[model samples]
Target: MSVEAELIAPAELGTSVVSDKGESIAPQAKEAASGLLDQGDAMTSLAQQAPSVVERMQDFLLVGGPVVWILLGFSIIALSIVLVKLWQFALLRPESNRDVTQALALWRAGEHGQATVVLKRNRPVSELVYIAMRGVLNVRQDMDLLKDELERVAALRLNQLRALLRPLEVIATLSPLLGLLGTVLGMITAFQRMEAAGNQVDPSVLSGGIWQALLTTAVGLAVAIPVVVIHSWLERKVERVAAVMSDSVTQVFTGQQISVVAEPELEELKRAA
Candidate 1:
């Protein structure tokens, strides 16, 4: 009887352990399933909302009329120009200082070959520096003529940077004016409708028209403000590049002049001695 009781107790202990593990695993499984369901629900809600958001934007644009469409075009153009200019600046690296400084130092040290190699980068400033160094060493041209050539090249480079800027300025200037025109036209149409309605004039109708008319001005200003700021910022960048080019080129010439003067003075001193 005692042996049988011990064997039965062992079986009961094993059963209790299995039951406890099962209870713990069941809650964990339920939690995992609930979390997956929550994620699926969120994804489904976002998918549904996406189309509605797009529809709202389309409706808003339609309500703003032709003027808004034109503004949208201008905004696209401005964005494209901005992207293109950014790409150009990145490729050209107009503000690169380290290589320019190194090249200038090499030039001043009379390592003309090394200076030319250092200025081999495909940058406007580097090009100008190389040309100046070459003109002094190889061309042996008069300083004045070389300076003139440098000036011309600098102008050409600056003009390249200034490209597409006029269109941006035009867009900024014309946007607000176009919006005002749209508002005027819209108001006139609303008034004509009110006159046609005579004594049955609805304030809601007038209010809707006025708001729609104002929408053009709002869109126009939105397009113009950022464009103006961007145009100014780009102009500043170009100006800075111009300054760097001028400074670097001037330093090269100035170093040449000092060397030239030193040579004559050194010869004169030797003769006097």
Candidate 2:
């Protein structure tokens, strides 16, 4: 009867074979329509269930206790930071060592401008290398000053790379201690309850508090271990970038120093000619 059903009915009935005994095609058409209706209902039901599932998760977090909830928050933050670092390295870190080597060769061959142009076009160059290449081209006599500037830039960018890592370090160190504190407090509460119910000492009271203590401790360890590993991995990556920056920039400026020293000698020989 509906517009959708009318349209679908013709397409479905064309595929279906009617009995030679003159069976009605109406039931088969209705069956096809019912299948479409069932699909729509299934989608509707899934949409309705989504919010209920979110509600259940919220309820679970609420019951996870403060220490557990704080650890949960740390876990999410750590995961996000790790993903960002991984993405950063994948984009910035080069797969081949030839980028720096080729650029160095260009600069040493009296093509200083061309070397910079090459570096600019290279997609996987480090930020440190890029900054150094831009600043060091005009540098001739002040190799010491250039070194100072490069060191300063390297330090600043290295710190930026290490930015979110400190929080992960803090989380790693604090989680286990928080778990222990929760366990101690839980034990204290359990004993107090036991003392108050001295004559009627229920086994449930003792066992229940102990389990809560264990749960908090377990959550803390779970949070701390992964946080520590992720922090270490990120720190290693930052260090590697720092080394590449330092080595590449040093190679470029070392050649520049040679050029500066030879410029005066070349000019003196020209006067003698």
Candidate 3:
């Protein structure tokens, strides 16, 4: 019998068997069972210790003796802001670089109505383009007034883009200072103890106290660095949106000018015809 046949039939559980090809089915079965048992033991160990792992993290964050539960609070706030911005950015990402370029090409070609229709199809960069081109369609509308309205709308969109960013900026600014304050407090406490001990102070105690004080500074930096990075990234996204608005508005104004200048020539041609 082949090893495969032996595995499927397994003549007897835990019994020795030699395949017709002289392969040892017994050993293979034993090894497979051993692997399964090892995996089971590992999973059981993890299941048993899962609660302790969470408990340990909770205890450390809550009791990591040093300067600033307030620093921890700042970290939490920064994290919340980061997450919210990430979600907002993901939803509002500018998705039509090529489509917008094509639509703008149409606008510049003196096809203002068709350009807006093309932009409408893109769904992302097109909204601003559509809004700008709306004013272009109405020739009697003052271009400057239309431009001013676009700016106001752009400002509101930008405000929305940067909504929670202020909190992140605040967190990045204050975490280090809070950490430094903690370090100072820790050093003061250590020195007060040394003074109280009056020549009997242990060197180890002083060293331990100094390190405890430094821990706050380390954690504060850890929180601040990532927050600064994320804040800068979010700011860049806002700038990208602004750039899109500017580019689309420029296209609208160009199309308007082209259409406006062409009108008198068309009338002259009509009179001649």
lDDT of each: 0.90, 0.76, 0.77
Candidate 1: residue 267 Cα off by (Å): 10
Query: In candidate 1, what are the lDDT values of residues 1-273, reduced to their tens digit?
Result: 699999999999999999999999999999999999999999999999999999987976898888888999999999999999999988888887788899888887778789889775578888999889888886658878888999999999999998999999999999999889888888988898899999999998899889888888988999999999999999999999999999999888888778668888999999999
Q: Which ten residues in a row have the lowest lDDT in candidate 1?
A: 115-124
Q: After superposition, how far is residue 125 of candidate 3 from its true place, in Å?
A: 4.8
What are the clash counts of all predictions, listed in order?
0, 0, 0
RMSD for each model, in Å, please?
3.7, 10.0, 8.2
Q: Please say which candidate is ahead in lDDT: 2 or 3.
A: 3
| Clash count, candidate 3 | 0
lDDT tens readout by residue for model 3, 75-181: 87887788887777676666446667777788877766677676643244567677777777786879789878888877877888889888888889988887788
TM-score of model 1 (CA atoms):
0.82
Q: Considering TM-score, where higher is better, how would the candidates rank from best to worst?
A: 1, 3, 2
Which sections of candidate 3 miss by over 4 Å?
1-59, 62-67, 120-125, 258-273
lDDT of 1 at 34: 100
